[model samples]
Target: MDLSDKQQRPVPQGPRIDRTFFRQNKKINKINKLKNKIILVRVLTEILLGALRIVHKRNTRAP
Candidate 1:
């Protein structure tokens, strides 16, 4: 019985650790996705603003 208990103890512990690790990994993935989205938005806005500036310059020079 003692040997059986010892063997069974490790089995449950293994899955418990895996579950917590999986949860942590999920959280990290979500945060990374959000960060990537924010960076993409910032880059797009910068490009749009630069284009607007260029257009404004051209219009002013033409007039």
Candidate 2:
């Protein structure tokens, strides 16, 4: 009886904790994805700007 009660008690609580944990994990994953996307955009913009600067310098020097 004691073992059965212990098992039953944990079973209900286990799923509850897991549900909350999964919800939190999903939120965190979404935030991480957004951050990564922002970082990627910033890096790409920097590279493009640098390339443009180099091209402009060459064009000006040629003339």
Candidate 3:
């Protein structure tokens, strides 16, 4: 028997996340956030140190 186009068409399911998979995804997201925070802090600290070095050199030259 030949199936009609409508009958052969597949049903569409929207995105679905199972419980275990969702939990794992949340854990990974948390880890990524922490890694980003650490990188941002390290970059800011380097910039501050560079500014301090510049200020120190100017202060020493002014005397």
Candidate 4:
């Protein structure tokens, strides 16, 4: 039952793969990172704009 012992059993084989899979995975990871960065920048810009609007309103309303 203890598969931890390498002598007890050989490692199970997994799906066969080629270099293309690795290259595609790397490209996908890079794209994901780019998407996340874009999203973060967009969210930050929106927050800053909202804050600026609030500040402008407060300044205009003050006597």
Overall lDDT per candidate, in order of appearance = 0.66, 0.65, 0.67, 0.68
Once fitted onto the true fold, the runs of candidate 4 whose alpha carbons sit more than 4 angstroms away are 1-16
Kindly indicate the candidate among 2 and 4 with the higher TM-score: 4
lDDT by residue for model 3 (19-45), tens: 666566556666666766899999999
Best by TM-score: 4
lDDT of candidate model 3 versus the reference: 0.67
* Model 1 TM-score, all chains together: 0.69
Model 2: lDDT equals: 0.65
How well does model 4 score by local distance difference test?
0.68
Which candidate number would show the highest lDDT if scored against the true structure? 4
Query: Per-residue lDDT for 1-63 in model 4, tens only?
Result: 222432232334567656666676566666666766899999999999999999999999959
Structural similarity to truth (TM-score) of each candidate: 0.69, 0.69, 0.66, 0.73
Residue pairs with backbone overlap in model 1: none
RMSD of 3: 14.6
- Please give, for residues 1-63, the per-residue lDDT of candidate 1 as tens digits: 122322122323543466766566566666666766899999999999999999999889954
Q: Give the count of colliding residue pairs in each prediction.
A: 0, 0, 0, 0
TM-score of 2: 0.69
lDDT accuracy of residue 61 in candidate 1: 95
The TM-score that candidate 3 achieves is: 0.66
